[model samples]
Target: KRRLEDGEDVLISGFGKFCVKEKKVRKGRNPSTGEVMMLDKRRVVTFKCSGKLKKKINGK
Candidate 1:
């Protein structure tokens, strides 16, 4: 949790990898109003499953 808060990647050998990515400020649109707006830069966490985990999930 601390590492994630610090924007660091965390890996679990047989499970998956958690990546901390930096997103730049960019333009976005509001679906309802169709108005353009600027989004603030922020950190996002993404996860990628390991091959072992994927295989298990697929019942391999």
Candidate 2:
């Protein structure tokens, strides 16, 4: 959690990896009113599973 908060990539060997991604500010529309708005820049965490884990989960 601390590494993720620090925007670092984390790897768990056979499990997978965790990464922090930065999203630039962009224009977006409100679904309800169709109004244009500026989206704020933010950091997001993403997870990618290892092939070994995927195979195990799929029973391959």
Each model's Cα RMSD: 1.1, 1.0
| Model 1 TM-score relative to the real fold | 0.87
What value does the lDDT take at residue 47 in candidate 2?
A: 91
Candidate 2 lDDT at 49 equals 100
Model 2 segments beyond 4 Å from truth?
Answer: none
**Which ten residues in a row are the worst by lDDT in model 2?**
1-10
Over 1-60, each residue of candidate 1 has an lDDT whose tens digit, in order, gives: 999999889999999999999999999999999999999999999999999999999999
After the best TM-score superposition of candidate 1, give how far the Cα of residue 60 lies from its true spot, in angstroms: 1.8
- Local lDDT at 55 for model 2: 100
lDDT score, candidate 2, position 24: 100
Tens digits of per-residue lDDT, candidate 2, 1-60, equal 998998899999999999999999999999999999999999998899999999999999
